[model samples]
Target: MTETKKTTEKTLRRFTLSWQLALGMASGFFVIFIIFAFVLSQILKQYYGRLPETLYQWLGITILLGGLFVFGFAFMLTRYILRPVKSIKTTIEAFEDDPMTNVRADRANVNDEFYDLVNILNRMIDRLQSLIGAQQQFVSDVSHELRTPVTIVKGHMDLLNRWGKDEPEVLEDSIKSSLAEMQRMETLINEMLNLTRAEQIPIENVQEVTEVGGLVHRVFDNFKLIHPDFIFTLDDDLTQDANVKVRQDHMEQILIILADNAVKYSLDRKEIHFALSQTTNRVEIGIQDFGEGLSSEDAARVFDRFYRVDKARSRAKGGNGLGLSIAQRLVKAYGGEITLESALGSGSVFTIRLPLQRENKNDQKLSN
Candidate 1:
């Protein structure tokens, strides 16, 4: 019974103001006309004796015309009220047939509740379309990336099975090639898992005030030790009061990804620079490298998973092309943005902007 009452209420709620107005107007007119007709007929009979046939005929015609007018007026009002709902239904059906259509709903000034519902549904559709497109592209990129290595390994194994097994030279070359491809595959899979985890990482997981300068210093030291042949510079222009809203570990991981990319692309110039600066609202961290800088076209897609500027060179450098993409997701998960600026042969700069946290005395104490 409770369920039935709730359902009834829901049904009634769908009716717009116009419907209620039309119903009330019709009911009020019906009562008024009934009383007026009875009163007029009695008065006419009492004063003028019997009524004429023409009078009755004219009265019948007037009643018919009034009823028709009322019916037309009520119908027009009801239809106007339902116009938004009809549009919503049509749009939904059209989308069900082909969702590639425009994801927005076209409706006039609908009732308040229904207007809100339409807006929510359109937003949901936008998100759904985005998720679907991303998933499809992700699958395509993964398959393409996996295919090359798998084909290489399989080809080498086939060669070994056919004749390379007995020939020592072919056996040694085939074994090395297969092992290298397998390692590449492993690295790609691991990075893909990292991106997946980054996508689902909760805000609470990274809810900590991390000092930007110290994090960069640590990363600089680590990279300096790891690549002793290359020059690493740190330019810290931020105040000691600079605190960013991010987890320390996530921030470090982001720095590592950017630094690694810089090191990989350092063509002839073996220098990499890390810079930290801040505005009133945001903290900016930059990793600049004098490298085989990418063209605008390449720069645009550099953050896409499995996208590499030079596949052959990337393979040679043991890069699976997922580093930047993973870094982007990780940074964005913490309300940060990662961007790239580069030109052909003019070096590249990767900048990460994190929203600055409100100045906290506790953060300074923690850093100490």
Candidate 2:
């Protein structure tokens, strides 16, 4: 019991980080002051030895002056050293109170490691805000997109309930339309789930270096088979193997999304082009179609979730407008970028750029 009591008292004596720092600095200064006073006392005693009666008085004066100097200097030093820490704490408290506040720590004038910490914290706050915005947008999109099919199903059911069941043709039409709407709702839910997963794919799953040329050609073959009516062609400018760090599924999904979009829009031309190019720093895959192109305003938002440049055309092609969005998400998650270019009368091209690795020594030697 006595040992436990002593341990508890010791723990209670522990100071907060700021207090600990102040106490440590004060203790160090006090130690030095004690040593200096001791040395001065000896010197004073030696010089005033003849006046031995006043020896005690001189020593006391020396100790008092040294104690005063040490205490005052230590107090100011501790406060000055911890000023940045206090500022960071206050900024954090303000941010917690109002997340949208644009409060930042004092980093511009100060040059210290704490500046790095503050910069990181500010970046985290920005990312948090972006995530919250994305989440709200996602919820709004789901609500808006699902409303059409839901309304259609409900209206048809109401019609059937109101004497439409007695008519054979109306009964059959309502049943068929309700079933179709239900299927579309199911697909929408699944695609939304896929979009969410695309945003959160495990990075470890995409750490492997994949040769992109072969993968592109494989997709070309698959598309050729899938859309035999359309001419599928591959144009390559690969002096060497173009490689990117990505998973096979990620590569395939992105290619299929672009190729599918090409096929959908190229109803008149019945041809799709796949262009693959490689450079020292990056690899590019372009999916081009000679179809009715989009205006600049629509092209700018091609990858936006549930955005359709031509709503009727997209619906006819059975596109919920999530395919390109998912593709863009996957590409970005793998440290890559996807872009679209189009003139209103001409065709559109979707290009993907992924960082490339330098040629290895063995590949260089083999080429030589």
Candidate 3:
């Protein structure tokens, strides 16, 4: 009942402005007509002795015509002012019904206030689109990432109960496998939390000059230490002069995530390649590995949080599957992009592109 009342009040308020303007115009015209009628009567009494019988009739006819004209003019003026507002209301209704609907208002030749409103609405729609896409991707990726660990945990428990009783060593191994699966689950949960935290924190405070090549080298060296069996090589294309404006820690984390994933998924003792190059406006970094490459469908979802191509293999290799997602987010935060190219059995490559800074060039020139 309260909601209904509130809605009715709102609708009444919307019409109030037009009605007020009409009433004001009507009052002003009435006052003017009275003054004119009084003046004419006085002039006739003075110059023509007394007013003729048709004088009153002619005066009434004139007033009636004037009132009609004023009414029409006021109505037209009110409608002209309210047209854009009505359009905005219709667009909002459509959006409420289906958010995917694109209802853009024409801004050309429009009043400045209306044009500003249209621009704001367009920006709001763009943000809504991004948010909805992210939400859908999160749901799909989380489902895929959870399934493998649950299956493995169940399988290991079953094995432990069946053969574990007969062989002590088998029981221990089964228990260990279950523990490993749990650990994988824990890691996945941690990665998800980290990703969420990263999304929530504003990046406004994070500004610094970052050396692109040096950051990549540090990440590579760290990965080499962690996965000693994997052969890693860095291309010399990236010079010491390559630098960009970004948060240093965030850039390092992005590189580490990509390089770490490459090392983890690559075949044992296989070579992983890291390459970097600078252009006039941007810098590109690539990480490639000879691993069990993904299918087209997998490639499409690799950057989604918690999505993995090979479920069993991903669990066996202890991947939470959020590395690429985190890496992509970090890259985008720095006004950069991350893309993947992969084929089954051949290999996979991940590339990152970041915008170059003027300060970087100035620094390089000074050093030279």
Best by TM-score: 2
**TM-scores for all candidates?**
0.70, 0.79, 0.69
Candidate 1 ranges with C-alpha deviation above 4 Å: 1-66, 164-176, 189-211, 228-231, 240-250, 267-270, 291-307, 325-347, 357-368
In terms of TM-score, which candidate is stronger, 2 or 3?
Answer: 2
Q: What C-alpha RMSD separates each model from the true structure?
A: 8.4, 7.4, 5.9
List residue ranges in candidate 3 displaced over 4 A.
Answer: 1-21, 24-62, 95-109, 136-144, 147-182, 190-209, 236-249, 290-307, 329-335, 340-346, 359-368
**Steric clash pairs (candidate 3):** none
lDDT winner between 2 and 3, please give it. Answer: 2
lDDT at residue 250 of model 1 (Cα atoms):
75
Whole-model lDDT values for every prediction? 0.82, 0.82, 0.78
Per-residue C-alpha lDDT of model 1 across residues 23-125, encoded as one tens digit per residue: 7776677667667777888899999999999988887787767766776687677777677776786678667867766846664678886888888878777
lDDT of 2 by residue, 124-237 (tens): 777676666667767888899999999999999999998686898898999999998889888888888778778866565665788999999999999888888998888999
TM-score of 2: 0.79
Clashes of 3: 0
Residue 351 of model 1 has an lDDT of: 94
